[model samples]
Target: MRRLRRLLLLLTCLAIAVPPVAVYSDAVAQERVQRRTVLDLLFGGFGFGRRAQQQPNYQQRQQQHRPQTRSEKPKTKKKVPPAIAVPEPVVVAKLPDARKVLVVGDFIASGIGDGLTEAFTEMPGVAIEARTNGSSGLVRQDYYNWQTELPALIDEIKPAVVVLSLGANDRQMMTIGGSKEKFRSEAWSKEYEQRVAALSSFVLEKKVPLMWVGMPAFQTTSMTADMSAFNTIYRGTVEKTGGTFVDIWDGFVDESGKFVVTGSDINGQQVRLRGSDGVSMTKAGKRKMAFYVEKEIRRILGDAMTIGQPQGGEAVSNLVVTTPTDAADIVRTQPISLTDPALDGGTVLLGGSALDKGSGRSPRDKMIQKGEFAAAPEGRVDDFRLDKRPQPIDPQKATN
Candidate 1:
């Protein structure tokens, strides 16, 4: 029984030793697995570093892939000079030696005539005949067509010079080939230009010197703008046609280009330059308009020295015929081949002879004695024809 107890105790001790050895073997196997995983991580990290070092940078790759362009200097802006306006040369008539001036246009032209009359009153030799109609323009042919009437009128007057100042009423529709066109429209503008050119050409064809006066600005802004545009067209056409375009825009406008009703007169006195309506001019304003034109006339007349002097070396005479003479005799009486100064009664040629101190009281005196001639009747106060009957205007004819 003692032997059996010893063997059993020894077997129990062996079982305990075997279990500890198995536990140690398991711990070692787990340690080997952990070491293998660490080695794999370190190798993979080295491989990634090598690949990164071998790769090219983005900028380097772009440089290799993209084509290069030659370097160029930055461009600089060039300075340009402002344009200066030069005055066009004036074309003088060569044919007729008559010194008579013919004025035609709208109401403004009547004012020009009045102003010229007053200006030339001192110089009795210069004659000014004004055929201005208030309600006249290039647009309305049914009323008074300047394009047609002007040629006939020129034939009747046989003037050495012509002055035109219409367009005030021309900002209206035009009838072209029975088709009505709106003013300032492409068609209307073209047709109007053609008409203006025709007038200018007609005057030039007659070898008559022409002065085209531009319209002044109105109190109405749109009117002012239209006038400005018309002036541009006039300036270009007149210059092209060898006519002088007189600009009176600056005279009626202030420094800022606004219309001024009052301004300094030629006499240096402050006076009303424009009428109450701002579209028309006052008496002083008319005189001012004439002032600009007079300068040009003087230049054409050889600086005013030859204004009273007869052209073609003909003697100045004051002879008068008591009896009426035939056309041939009348033509013969004008020995100067220039003009019939006697047309105005101020410088009538007497007896087809040279100026002599002995002529039964000069023609001017004779007219005064006979009471046949008198100072220009005082102009009607209502110069605008407001007192006259207003003609019916076609609405279709109305424009800007």
Candidate 2:
């Protein structure tokens, strides 16, 4: 009886569970078929789930959506620019064993030469000779005829380059063909230009490059004007003769194009450039003058560098090109003595050191006490002495 009851209860429980499970399974299967049918309608029939019907051609749909022109227009191709060719690098030749530079001019050129000398001091295998005649120029050939003497000078100096600066003394009467012509006159200009051309051409004729440096502004406006005129003539002549003309007028002047006595040095320090007389230059001024010419030389030489050999072709063994040491070491390094008497400016008017001599009397004081108006060794004759009557010689002495 107990076993029959247990079997009947178990059959009743299964009947209830089976109906719910079968219903869920049938609903799930229907939902799956509906989803597949929707997918087939939206996408192509060859996608996920089973296919319900064939899909429309995607290519046809795209053709329908896309608008077409009446007739397919011909397309134009875009143009492209051609590539630019690059230039080859320039190869500069190295400098030779020894190179000599000749610097000749008036006082200004003398200063330039000094500056160049200092500039090239450390540059090995390079030598410079400053053959400047301070009181000489293109004018006054009787004083020192550069046009007639330049050839002999070149031969003697044997320089690789010639630098000429003149015309500072040319603003006077020019004697030509047994006649005197005032400065800036047609005859004077012609003769002056001829002399300049002759001098400049001689350098070129010797197979050397010529650099004719131009003059700077002077303290005197009239003098400066004359220098400007001279520079114009120099520029024209130099260019025509195939020589380099270095203009340094701009360097020595201020912003307003006026002359400046004190200006910036090469190192850019403010110092006195023009001297007290306003005609010559200071040490720094001279260096700055050379700076312009040096630039042109380096440009033409194609970056020529310093070497280890001397100008005489001797190898540097014991000498060091440069050194950094104490101030005392520098003082002792040079060959010259600091106390040399020949270099002493003592006894030079207004330049010597005033010795006290323990008498508390300065050299200037002694001069004032003595009422000395003229310098010694070349004293000027006093008016009183000139006023004296000529001494009559004895007749006997005159006969003897």
Candidate 3:
């Protein structure tokens, strides 16, 4: 009994001691796992001198696994718009004895002269002489008296045609017989008409044809109305004195008769015709204004205005025929009439010859004369005789 008790006490002590040792070993292993070095975390290994090697950083690993971006693309250049092309005027040399066209009046006359120059650029027989004072008008006679100056100009230039475009600056009061008269007033109209008659009579006396160009519509309604009245006075006075009055009012206005800044040009193209001031004309406006005057000039001048020809009515021949020295050496032949059949040495016209009666007539002739169509050939698509077999219908056509 004593031996058995000793053995039991020894076994109990072993169990208690063995369990404590195992618990201590487990705790030690857990502590070792928690207390890791920086190199062990990066390399995924323990810090105990085993498997010691340099490892990749977090950023480097992320970069290695990152998706690659598209290759750098080249930048495309911007497209530039083309510059507008302006047509340069063709300059032609004038003849020494070119007929002179004398242009006179205000600054508007200067624009007309420029236009006429371009109009007759191709015609070497015509020359334009522009003599204008921008601020001069019949209303301001003392400022620049056209009555005295025009006669001298007519004698000096010896112009074939005298073109007058004025009244743009004649809206102010006029001094008549040392008395100031308002524009379009009873006294002013009489003196203005007299001045116009005097100017036209000067050109008529010189045997020079006169063309008086009237004013165009303005942006201001009052100014436009004044111009209209002035045009009326100009037309009556000019016609009475046997001078021509050029009405350019329609050219600068719309279909409704209202003033237009942009309108059809001489070439029928849409363009800016007037300046911002509304009174002044643009290059296109000047060209268009001349177009109206050009027609009258051509009509009055007649054959004298023929382009690409000499001043005199002379014919230019390209062929040169040499005549025989002796009359007997020349041979004469009878002229044949265009209606005579002998001209072509044939009686019947082309394809009009009669065919042989034995030969069968064409299907067209048979249908026309006998009202009968030729029979369709055998195995043909259009053959529809009562005894013929029916053709197979097209599958595609049936589906359609």
TM-score, one value per model? 0.52, 0.53, 0.59
Per-residue alpha-carbon lDDT of candidate 3 for residues 212-313, written as tens digits (9 for 90 to 100)? 999999999999999999999999999999999999999999999899999999889999999999989999999988887877776656555554665464
For candidate 1, the TM-score is 0.52
Query: Which clashing pairs does model 3 show?
Result: none
Alpha-carbon shift of residue 290 in model 1 (angstroms): 0.6
Please identify model 1 stretches exceeding 4 Å from their true place: 1-98, 303-400
The residue ranges of model 3 lying beyond 4 angstroms of the native Cα positions read 1-88, 307-400
Clashing pairs in 1: 319-349, 319-350, 320-350
| Residue pairs that clash (backbone atoms under 3 angstroms), model 2 | none
Using TM-score, rank the candidates from best to worst.
3, 2, 1
Better of 1 and 3 by lDDT: 3
Q: Where does the lowest 10-residue lDDT sum fall in candidate 1?
A: 314-323
Residue-level lDDT of model 2, residues 216-278, one tens digit each, is 999999999999999999999988998989999998999999999999988899999999998
**Sorted by lDDT, highest first, which candidate order results?**
3, 2, 1
Please list the C-alpha lDDT of all candidates, in the order they appear: 0.76, 0.77, 0.83
Model 2 scores what on Cα lDDT?
A: 0.77
